[model samples]
Target: MDKIQNQVRPVFPFTAIVGQEEMKLALILNVIDPKIGGVMIMGDRGTGKSTTIRAIADLLPEIEVVADDLFNSHISDYDLMSDFVKNQLENNANLTTSLIKVPMVDLPLGATEDRLCGTIDIEKALNEGVKSFDPGLLAKANRGILYVDEVNLLDDHLVDILLDSAASGWNTVEREGISIRHPSRFVLVGSGNPEEGELRPQLLDRFGMHAEIRTVRDASLRVQIVEQRTKFDQDPNSCIKEFCEQQNLLKQTIINAQSLLKSITIDYSLKVKISQICGILNVDGLRGDIVTNRAAKAFAAYQNKKEVDVDDVKEVITLCLRHRLRKDPLDTIDSGTKVSQVVDDILS
Candidate 1:
């Protein structure tokens, strides 16, 4: 039998995207520090939530991964596959490393539970009388990004599966006398129109940050967006060529930011401020505090700063903890308004 060919898919350019700076920043922060967990973008439809995520493919730094691994396992000290792969390597075993662009797999709304979790290859097993594990989206998304559109409308079962995988950084499956476990760590990026439905609280809590985006109301910006999009649709090759230089520069900036992220430090004062903000907001768990601190650090790193400052903390607090705040019956305060109030109180 002939081997099947895999085709490369095109992704939108990050530099070409028009607006929604907050969403772009949140996604960039997560990439700089995956320990920030993930980001959720909830807003009106057609506001470029999905486009912004797809654009991420252009900005990611290339990663060195173990060749032929189901999870695109990283060859690093902190890698989840370090134990297994290291043992194999120490036994005079040979391992190949491949330079691959980071993955950004989309989980469609209609995806089945099994498809998301992976399942047995019954056909392959029956014909060959051998057990074969058919990898799923989660497996392919390892060490990359997993984007879900209309996430609020995804089935409850799928949401549960995602939460479990996101929490453990691994996906485990058992059935038909087969048990399999694989590293499934991926930065989760979920976008949805909040008006359509509410995301389950369990799933919502898994997100490290949340950004709300709306359509560009500025007439000039809107016009420019439309014109640029029309031009790209009409002549994709030339249109992309026109922006390729800028996009490449932006990609390098991301690579530089990632390199700097490791050296960025968080100040004790800023840590207290982050804690105070979360405490004032009455956020329920320690996750909020951890994410806010990490995001602030990443934001500073992105700005090429060596230390986190109050401004960086203020800028990322809303994205990190807005969705985790306690609501007051009489306040009727939106997350944005509440965040602003907190910043004002802190800065004052």
Candidate 2:
């Protein structure tokens, strides 16, 4: 068993987070539409970046997965399973599912490729003449969250591997005398303080949305945050209980949005505006349009609307465009500001 699997603790409630509304919204959008990719959080240390990301785990509703499958493969993913597994699933009308926590995997900076992508079980191969695989962090994170703290400082090779796996939604480990491929889909959340170092442009481009946060400067707000933290530490069970009702409501909201997302629609005019805004900003590719479209649909669903609106577009513009904007020598404004300006020009 993985060490992380062994070390379990209660996560703080998402409702307990004091501020950073944008961060919270962005995370919810991703849950509604994983196709928006994942969010990159660049901020000051002790700003609750990690805490907010971790709290997301508990708010998520439990997933129904294969009872005996370590990969947590959903029943609908039978086509992606191995031949034997597919046959087993097909033959068994008695297929069982167990509700498990939505996995929240922490990818430490010093992790190795084999550790990320699993390794062949050498003991089984040598002693029993049977080939077996030991799953890794990426496998554990399948269909869930893969969170990297201090992502900017991660090794280049590891970053590249992460980028590839994140892009393809699958991982293949061919070394250690065994080859294995599995569904490794996950929402890739990364956070780092910009003062430490800048993220590689390649990896930066891989993220679907970007949010920059700072420590709360308001005296009263800071005091509120401290009190919340103190309460959580003193009696976590009570603290979690206090927020349980809200968490349950939020969880149901997310679940409803997931099912409603497919039915949400946008008019051609709004779609054109999405394209034009990205064009005016000179974003590198169609990724901006796709992310914006998906985000808007998610926002609409979250709001219990069947069709997207201009407000939906406005709500997610900064997050979708900030990281994808191209730099110009003459433009000195912040990326978020630039996005806001273009959105205002087009949608106003």
Best by lDDT: 2
lDDT of 2: 0.86
What does candidate 1's lDDT look like per residue over 1-348, in tens digits? 111211133455777888898999999888888778888999987887877887786567678898877778776645567345766777867889898878889998899978898888777777898767888999988888999898899988897788678767989877766667888888898888988987866668789999999888899999999997788767766776787898788777777778898888997877887788778888888888898888988889888899988788878988988788765668777977887798789855
Candidate models: Cα lDDT each: 0.81, 0.86
Cα displacement (Å) at residue 204, model 1? 1.2
After superposing candidate 1, which stretches have Cα over 4 Å from the reference?
Answer: 1-10, 76-87, 120-131, 176-178, 328-330
User: Residue 40: error of model 1 in Å?
Assistant: 0.7
Best candidate, TM-score: 2
Worst 10 residues of 1 by lDDT: 1-10
The global Cα lDDT (0 to 1) of model 1 is: 0.81
Superposed by TM-score, candidate 2 places the C-alpha of residue 196 at a distance from the truth, in angstroms, of 1.2
